[model samples]
Target chain A: MKRRRPFLLFTLLAFGYAFLYVPIISLIVYSFNVSRLVTVWGGFSTRWYGELLHNDQILSAAWLSLRIATMNATLSVILGTLAAITLVRFGKFRGRTLFSTMVSAPLVMPDVILGLASLLLFVTMEHLIGWPAGRGITTITLAHITFSAAFVTVVVQSRLSQFDISLEEAAMDLGARPWKVFLLITLPIIAPSLLAGWLLAFTLSLDDLVIASFVAGPGATTLPMVVYSSVRLGVSPQINALATLIVATVTLCILLAGWLMHRQETLRRRAPVIDIS
Target chain B: MTTRATINGSARNAGEWLGDLLTGHHGRRLVIALPYLWLLVFFMLPFVIVLKISLAEVLLGRPPYSPLWQYLEDSTVQIQLHLDNYRRLWEDPLYFIAYLKSLKIAGISTLVCLLLGYPMAYAIARTRDSLRNLLLMLVILPFWTSFLIRVYAWIGILKSNGLLNNLLLALGVIDHPLALLHTDFAVYLGIVYSYLPFMVLPLYATLSRMDLTLLEAAADLGCRPWKAFLRVTLPLSLPGIIAGCMLVFIPAVGEFVIPDLLGGPDSLMIGKVLWTEFFSNRDWPAASAVAVVMLVLLVVPLALFQRAQEKSEGKPPL
Candidate 1:
């Protein structure tokens, strides 16, 4: 208040954002640089991107990661939605406290604990039931869903708690069955949060390195595994390009999700009728 | 309607029965049980399995450890259990150092995050609505991207010949490239950089929702801005601060990627130790023991969190 300009605050804000964005921007810029050494910028070129496409290992790992992420996200949504529904719609169910603990526990559990435990689970299951054969994409997806679903449960639970129960009761009163009421009323209402949850789960699976590393076996190397091994050696231009592409895709998806959510909120404010559809 | 009546009445009866099975109390019960059952099998079972393995002795053969039970004739029973893993963990100085070191790093990084994040969160909270949304989006966008890649980005920037050093040299600020990468400082940087969003979001939520009138009232009472902030805003946002710190600290203690990527060989984190004990050392029992101990160590904080959540929700906690 004493000073006309809050220069210090502005500088801190700028520095914080710069600290956040500068590294990412640098990674993207160096991806375009036609040089073996990342420090030296030869010129702007798409040579690395071209090289990235030709790399078979990167391509296969990427496809594998995508398949796993999609499956993980879908399963997470199904399981987490059920958990959220149980908590919010079904009041005071048996084992409510235990259920809450289990649902929320994984949110803060370390990836190391999760990875080790799940790996042990898979190994023991294989010995007992001769199932899962050997760890690969299937094991990875299971490991991912275990944690991601907890996250989905949190997201969906928050949204569910805020929802007006009257709408669902109204539908039920109009001669709709419980399942029908849920399908016709609750599902549509929570679809945005569900989408957010799914996207969140997908991103989590895609980004995971430590857990996936532990669970994955032979011929099951994921994108992160590839990047991890490559990064351990050194930073290659190809990885930079791959990272830039990932950044672009993720930013686009997030912005789109934000826009969709904002639009839904605006529409809901304008007319409550539109929310039902 | 007449044509519908002509159809078999048993079909409608069956339909209702099926619908009842799908959407009735029993059906809802099934839906609730599905996730619970999954967690039981995957989450809870794993801990049990880890505990069991920790109790058993390591073996050379495939699948390693033998069954813990050995039943004999004449009503005699023997248990093939060993406390060697736990004993080893206690005997080894490395484990103690690693635990202490991890806590120190996690704590320091959490503090740095709070200092850095408070201003950013306040800036966003004080901004207009539209701009605030955009700024918040920017804060979260980094989170959407790969965390590993963000860590990797730090490697290039902090490398001796990388961008930061190059810029410093070109500006004549430093005649030589400093040894910035592969140090505890780099580990701190990586953790703080990556976990900043987690710190900012909760703080912003609390700060933005704070009633400005409280601060105004404090100012009217002859409180300076700093005093008003300490008296009013800080206390109000304490919950968020606690939450953000917990969120950052818990994961940081078990972080493997950041420390492994950015830290020097001297940086001994429990996560990395566990990884090596499992994979490199091939000591599954020891690794399981490490995990169990870590879980036990975390149980107190986690219970506190659950209590905090229950209090906020204003429910009778179980």
Candidate 2:
């Protein structure tokens, strides 16, 4: 029975990983197919990659998406770090429940609802104050920041909550002000989490299609928006090339992050202990 | 004391007061207020607008919703509230069925994810440290990839002349290509594939943290392995199960990309319904009403998920 259980588990694990990966592997292989049809491979070629590069619509959309993602990630990291600090450091502030709820609620909120509501809000704001003027990059970035900040807050909050308070207190004891202590002691300790949060927000903003579709105006087409429109017309080799590029880039980033983390671990272990005695 | 006196004396100037408020003792308040106000304006205020728009009549104008209130010539306010949008949702079986169908699909998908994910998570949790980390990274690696790309990959596999059909035909498993794409089954496959990581991560977390000694004690007490797992591991992992299920179910219910890309015309999910109402049909009021109703349906589970999250704040969530 014991041997059978391990075998069952191993099989299940193998199947699970295969289920997750096989489609991606097949898609990667087909990206190089010379034929227009996805099923038939007419030898290998880089023609689709060349075509993708020349597609003006896709290029512009990718540029717009990159800009929006950069802006969203930067703003989300700031707001998320503040929200995390509030939740972790502030002890029993007024409206704390509501504050925490507002911070976390966006994580599970449906994209359709969030999109519809945000679009309505932008319209109402425009009608009332005429601040935004119209929906475009600004509106989509704002919408992305709102939800992405929630995810960032979760990431930062977990790290902050586990942090030791004595480090900050020690900095304060050495005559550093509260802000200085936070900047010098607290921020450095939690910088890794902040980076993770930033990357997460960047990816989320870049990948969003539904919310961006709702909040975006005529000119501001994101990469996902362009991809969705083209994908609806059925699978194309260009999209496959684009997908392959995205998958490869992301995999490379993850591997780089993993290697950096491992090196950091080794460096920390090798550091000489302070002779406090 | 001298610095405080000087600061109080300088507080007569607005710039000094503002600077003091930002960099001085009120820094804590600034930290709390910034994100608090951002969410209030962007996240919370939008829901109020949705509720307001849901009560307004659909109009053929720029914003596409009639005014809820207007000042008459006599300066008396006339309030116009049209509940027809909500009423239409009730009268029209399409909206009702879509909600039901979304719930059914999300529920079934969540269950399938749990069944498939639980064992994998358990296996990973039981592995040695280095292998476990590698396995966990493998689960998260797909999650970091583009969601649209993942869903799009299935189209190439599920279409009539797709890879799966071709492979099956070559193996002589089927005489003809079976209809796979644009089906309810395809939607299920997409949801399970996409959300499987969300289920596994949380389950792995709680399962890894579980006390294995209790299982050993159960076995020593003459309990069979299955019986010990039922009593010890399964019950112990209930929180993870709930967390994992909610993570999968909440998003799956309102999932737009998966259903739209993979589902056929007959597959009526509320997210697609809402999308069509807003984008294709250009019915803002109706879409707002649909969103408000969907929010109402999800509020309880969302609150429960938050409570669980608050209870486990130090632990990271996927």
Candidate 3:
């Protein structure tokens, strides 16, 4: 029984994973179907992709989403980096506990509540300051930044935890200004983690449906919103085609990230040992 | 020269004092505090707003507007605050029933994920060193795909005449295609598909970190393989089980997409209700109330779980 256990376990594991991915594989395969109804597989055709290309609404929504995601990702990284640095280095100050909790709250808080509260915030900010005057891509991007930064902060914090403080101290001792030390020594080491965090933020913002729906105003529909509305109309081959492309792109990115991380780990392991005389 | 030395001495004193202030137990407190503040402001504050709105009446499109004293004047308001929503919720049996249904669906899905993910995580963890990283990476490959697209893919698989049915029919197993789409079963399947990786990763973390010495010792004592696992391994992995449950259950309860996409019209999870109130109905007050109640229901249990874990571990809960 013990000898067969591992093999049994592997089979079960493989089956479970296959269950997870097969639906996705099916969707991708059927995206090329010429048939409109989901049942029959007509001869393979790229008509859906052709239709998607000319659909101005979908293209514009995609562009808007891309712009917002890019902005949100960049802003999230900057703010998250600052927050992570402060949390790690400053360690303790007045209301530190409160700040820590607030930062993490976004992670577990229901998306519906977050979206509603953010919409409320945007409206209130408009009333008070008469700035960010309208709800559109700007407000939506701002909202995404709030939660996405929280996520980035978590990743950056974990990365920073494993980092040594002495690297900064050594730079400072070698006649480098604080900014210079951060730029030269600290930033490079944490670059991969920062990149990872940015990617995470970007994907989250891009994938966001509930929050984006809440904050979006006229002319700010995203790819998710489009897909959601279209799904309501009924699942079509166009959506399958879109999903296949997204899944393919993301899978490629994940593979690249995995390879890059592995290379970095191996390089770190093989780094020449310094002998202190 | 004397002044300069004195100034330098004082500066050095201040630096040491700062260092002392943040060292040892005090340092851990400080390190943990920032996260606490963040949760308090963003997480705690939103709930506070929800609670405040839940109490007040719907005047216009905005949340409640009643002053605290005015609210107090109606003695009904005191107890009515809680009763108002609960009464409203009770009046609509649909809401309560939906909650129960959602809980049942989420609960079963979490269990399914545990069964599937535990073996997968174990297999990956027990793999040879060279293949371990590759296997683990493959396991998480789906997560990088957009969540929406992944869920969207399910429509093709679960539809009436979809892939599963097509394949089954070709094999001559059944004369008719099974009704698989727009069912509670489909909802559960979607949820488990999405959340399985979450359970696997945590279990993997704990399992890989597990020391083999105890298991070896148990085996040496002539315990059967299963008996050794029960006595030595299972007990050590309870923490991971709890963590995985929390990770799956918390978000699963609030999930909107899976149910909306896969579930039939009768499927009415609180998340979808909340969305409908906000978007379709445009009743902001009612939506806020629902959002408030859901948060309360969710947070109380989670807090209790955290407290329980803390008590067991004999540490303050993070």
Candidate 4:
């Protein structure tokens, strides 16, 4: 019943945030260190960033990862939206239990299992059908899509469930076809969630390492793979630079998204109400 | 339904039938069928393949696992089910210890995350809307960054002569740099850090939706604030607690990166074991066996998580 914030809880929150951000802040700080050693601070410089830029392996891997992430994001949004529609709109179809489980299970399923199982599937498919020929970008993208779509589905499903069905019904009653109603009424309303889903899938695919490692064949390496190999030997300043870049990009994207959503919210609030009656 | 009837009654061409299928009841079926078939083939069927592979012998072939079925020279079919993979998993103390350690590590990390995250989530949930949004974003912002990178960041902090040690030395907290990285403690720190947001978001969802009036009633009934929280808020947040714990515990159990990066040689998590089996040993059957067993271990928690999700969503249990 106390409306005021508790001091202990607020302190805890501060500590929690500090715990979360300190490593990141430090990582960013060390990225500019001139010294090769990660722990010690030599003078501040951008040498690692320069080294990172010139590293052909990291660049090629980053390019490959970006391609996979883009394809995975686009494909996941489609699959996830359909899955969300099935769960939230279809209403108690046969195998709805299994369908729902399949849609969400990937979110919590271990990445190692997913990676291993998917690799096995591709191997079997290659042996049986002789299609896909061998694992590469295509296989990695497919594996990413499978799990990333689950994340997208969760995002879209929550939005779809909150949607007002009567809007679509009203459009339908006014002589619009089902698809037309969906396109004109439902799509616009859920577009924000779709965008969120797409971004989530994209980031997930980009960040994935274990699954990509499992499914990637010889010659196909992702950014995370390169980072993992380098980081394993010990922390490198170039990796610190790469991490700083990733953190900066992600932070920028999130802030932009937040601003866009806020603007949309304000515009919606300011819009005059339509009196159809 | 009427559309289907009308199409059946009047459709005399493939185009009409296709249109009906696209726009009518069958279209709904198609929407459901696409993702369903995709998951069935890619998600569910892989487990079946893993099970089959788990039953096969390790081989010196390209695939590295023997075929489950073979056609013999004579008029006979040979079915080889090598149960040794599973038997070896049970018999081997290395795997047994790894599984136990994985569960133990995941359990402790989940507990730690819950402890650290609950108050944070509650604070955010109880805040004004604008501040709440900003706070929640802060919590999730790190999550949006690369998970591997975030985990990698800890190495600099926890390693010998790392930031923490240097700071500690300067502060006279300890004379020697602590052996923090590549230890069980670092693994716990990494898991808890990475999974804290997962715990917080779900808890905040439940906590924010909680009715303050109930707390008010408890307060009016001569109850202390802490007691009111214990009796009312804690009980109400059980679903979130379960969901959050499951979310943290499930993947953490099979976490490969945290352990591989931060854990010492003694940290024998099943995920690391499975990875070594598949990649280092090139024993697909052993890896498949490990996966099958891990799935079995997680089946209960996974079900619990699904139920909690359905409950939170106000959906009927299947």
Candidate 5:
């Protein structure tokens, strides 16, 4: 009975994993399926991928999404890192609790509400400054930055809790200026966490549909927006192809990151042994 | 000696004090506080604006916002004034019903996730160390993909004449495709699939932390496996269950994408309604009101959940 129990557990675990990923698996498989219906099996072909490459609208939207994601991520990391350092290190003051809550509010706040608020902000800005006259890439990018930075702040702050301040103190004692210490020691130590936060922010900005849809004007159509409008009409194989590409790229990047981390750990262990020698 | 005396002047001490003020022990706090201020300006202030706008009357096609902004400039804007939007919300039964329906849907999906996630999490937790990491990785790998794409994949599966229907037809289960898409059932499935990982991680955290001897002790006391689970295991794991539910339910209530994509016309969740009011309808005032209400609904529960979590963590409930 105990032996049989292991087998049952294995089967259950396998089923659960399959349940989690089968839809995604099927989508990737069907992207290469020549058949139009996603359900049916057809001979393998890459025609959809070919079609995706040739589609101008899809390509442009993808470009726009990438651009916005990069900008949003960069801005988010800068702001978030600063905020994280302050909140975790400084700890308490007047309105500190309120400030912490405000920073994180965007993380849980409904996307629709965020979109409206951003739109309202834009309108108010337009009325006051007579700039950013309409919803465009700039507005969308700014909106993305708003929420993405908040998320990045949380990630960086959490990571900061694990950081040792002793290294910076040592650097300062060794005749480095405070800024120099931060740049050389603190930044390098926290770089991986910052990178992770940046990646998360980038992915979030790229994948945003609802907010982008709200703030996007004619020229600012992001990939998600394009995919959404297309999906609303009906399922298209092109979307399947696009999604497949994204999933593949993301999966590869994640695996690469993991491998790099593993290799770094291995090298670190080897370095200690070499030093002992 | 004279040069040294000049260099050690009081002005240098004053400058040092100013520099200390700028870069003190709390400098990091001041640096981090900048983002919080930005959030207060951009994120929290909008809610305040929403509250203010919700009070103003809708005149002609334009919203009554300018006057309210002016009223804010003056001392005449009574903070305690507006109950009309709240009153209207109460008078309209549909709004309340929509909130209830959303809660029910979110609740059921959260429950489903918990049921499915617990066993999976347990299996992963109990696995041999070598394989455990791989199993956990597999569980989290899907999360790296775009959530929207994952949800979109289900559309292909659930649509009439879709793969699931075709597979069933091929198996001679049914002659016709079932109306699976555009239904509350589909929305629930989507929610469960999306939120399952959230449920899994928390359960895994709690279960992994557990000492196996407690279960063994229950067994020694003549408790059966099921009884052991009910008595010892369940109580120990309630923290995880609560955490998982909060993680799933909080976001699920505000979910827009799944319902917007998979739900039918009748399945008008507040998220979709809110989206329309803000974007398509361009009724910012009404949209703000709805948003404010949603925020209120969420914040109260969120506070309660956090309080519970804090208590479990052995802290005074804030």
Candidate 6:
């Protein structure tokens, strides 16, 4: 493969990554610009960072977003784990096709359609059943769960399918109850993936704008909604500050996850060799 | 003694059967029913409602639509059907134009992502295992950040006095700061930048799994590198190319963020149109009609493609 000219390959990777990172790096740098003008940088200052802290609307929205995301992630995990287990554990059951189809439906569905459809559902259900009397945080969270559950299901299901089931069988053979087998043997083994799925859902919910906008009422502004409305006016250094903070936090988390994953990989490799010996 | 043993065996069989009844396929099926039922109630039912609303009259009311039924008695009801929403959608040139423009933009963006992502995915796929892991991680790590933030970052780069224009001005590429911010070009850039990862990951999946021996054989037979690539690599990686394109194109068609933020008012994507009609015009039925029409335009071809792919791959139809 190296016999083919490798120069072009290196150039493409360089340009591609430069395209991806330069915009982000510039955004971070401009966050500290002293001047109010975003395009030109005066000397470095933390004015925007200070401003961001004092902005109560953004702060409250961020808090609400965090609360909703936490709840959404938790619900998504529980529901997603259930769906994954069903698809993996149940064999040729009734409505299997519909279950699988619905599980993956939201992955590619347009947000406009999804949001519209769900909003319509809430409206009719509100009028007919008098449950969820209005769309707000509850409706938003449920709507978030509807799509994020699909994401969680995809993640957990893949991990579940790859899982070894003989351990559960062995536990069952030893007179463990069915629920006990699931509790002790299955859940623990897939816990890491469930964590990953939860994190994915959390990020997705936190970042969402379009779907949330559709379902959210006046009082239910999320962080993204606040940022979006602000951006519509003009780019602000405060938003840059927020973006920089988000990028840093995400980068740190990913690095930590990568390191942990690498360590686990090495441990698994070593343990297998020890067993063979 | 034989009769006593036989009786004991039969008794144990009955106990096992009862245990199976309590903790068997039937019980597991009920456990499975929970999420399935949740989706049936929430996900599928909403589409039904959307469909219902699309066929109803938009009115100023609590729910903002006329109900399909008027109860005259316990068993008698009147059914009212409205086709004006559909008819209006058919007559409106704006809706049709938005659909065409969306397809064009999405198609071009998919092409651009392919052009950029192919080489990157190829390079990563061809790298050694350790390097490949790191490269793949780098490609994916940015996605963990807020998508809105990522798109926002582009404003600083694409604005008149922003990074790209300033750099070009400094280099004397052009005398004036170009109108790079609010145009089809910016929209293209936004879509390509946002969706490049979607393209690369799928392509990498396919490319890495490719049997390199075929390429080696072609090389040994004195085939030129580019020809070998076309004959061997391209054909083998068609699945990835298709997957990546569909992933980018389908979502791009209904994309609201990029066009709303980056593209000018005339951008006219169906998503933006639907939103304006609902929020500004307060036309629930019209918006619903637009959504229904958009779903048809997007879903039907994809459904056909999915069925074809599943058949070819020998997977379960679902």
- Report interface Cα RMSD per prediction: 3.4, 2.5, 5.5, 2.6, 4.3, 3.5
**lDDT tens digits by residue: candidate 4, B152-268:** 999999989899999999999999999998899999999999999999988988898889999999988999889999999999988889889999999999999999999999998
TM-scores for candidates 1 onward, in order: 0.93, 0.94, 0.84, 0.95, 0.85, 0.90
User: Using TM-score as the measure, which candidate wins?
Assistant: 4
Residue pair clashes in candidate 2: none
TM-score ranking from best to worst? 4, 2, 1, 6, 5, 3
Put down candidate 5 lDDT per residue, B10-94, tens digits, no spaces. 6776665654554666665567566766777677776776777777655445333433534565567534345566677789887
Candidates, ranked, DockQ: 2, 4, 1, 6, 5, 3
Per-residue lDDT of A276 in model 4:
29
> Candidate 3: what lDDT?
0.74
Question: How well is each residue in B1-318 modelled by candidate 2, as lDDT tens digits?
Answer: 999878878764555446446656587789888999999999999999999999998888898889999999998999999999999999999999999999999999999999999999999998878898899989998998899999999999999999999999999999999999999999999999999998998899889888888887887899998898898999888878877888899989999999999999988899999999998889999999999899999989898877867766667555
Model 6 — TM-score against the truth? 0.90
Q: Each candidate's lDDT (Cα)?
A: 0.87, 0.90, 0.74, 0.90, 0.77, 0.83
Error of 6 at A256 (Å): 1.5
Model 5 residue B160 CA deviation in Å: 1.7
What TM-score would you give candidate 1 relative to the actual structure?
0.93
> How many clashing pairs does model 5 include?
3
Runs off by more than 4 Å, candidate 1: A1-7, A274-277, B1-22, B73-77, B220-222, B312-318
Tens digits of lDDT, candidate 1, A49-154: 9999999999999999999999999999999999887877787877888888888778778889999999999999999999899999999999999999988987
Looking at model 2, residue A27 earns an lDDT score of 85
| Tens-digit lDDT string for candidate 3 (B1-318) | 999999999997776566555443574465455445444544455566656555655555333333232446546553334336556876898788877876787788889888888888888877878988877876677766778778877877778778788888899998899998888888988899888877887678677778987777787788887898787777787766766666677678878998999898877788888888777877665777777677767775465445333332311111
The stretch of ten residues in a row with the least summed lDDT in candidate 6 chain B is: B309-318
- Mark the regions of model 2 whose C-alpha exceeds 4 Å error after superposition: A1-5, A272-277, B1-25
Q: Report how far off residue B57 is in candidate 2 (Å).
A: 0.9
Q: Report the C-alpha lDDT of model 2 over A77-160, residue by residue, as the tens digit.
A: 999999998888787989998988887678878899999989999999998999698989999999999999999998898889
lDDT of 4 by residue, A1-277 (tens): 3476679999999999999999999999999998888888899899999999999999999999999999999999999999888877777877988887887689899999999999999999999999678999999999999999988888888888888788777776777666666666788788988999999999999999999999999989999999999999988899999999999999999999888888877886897342222
Which residue pairs overlap in candidate 1's backbone? none
Model 6 - which docking category? Answer: acceptable
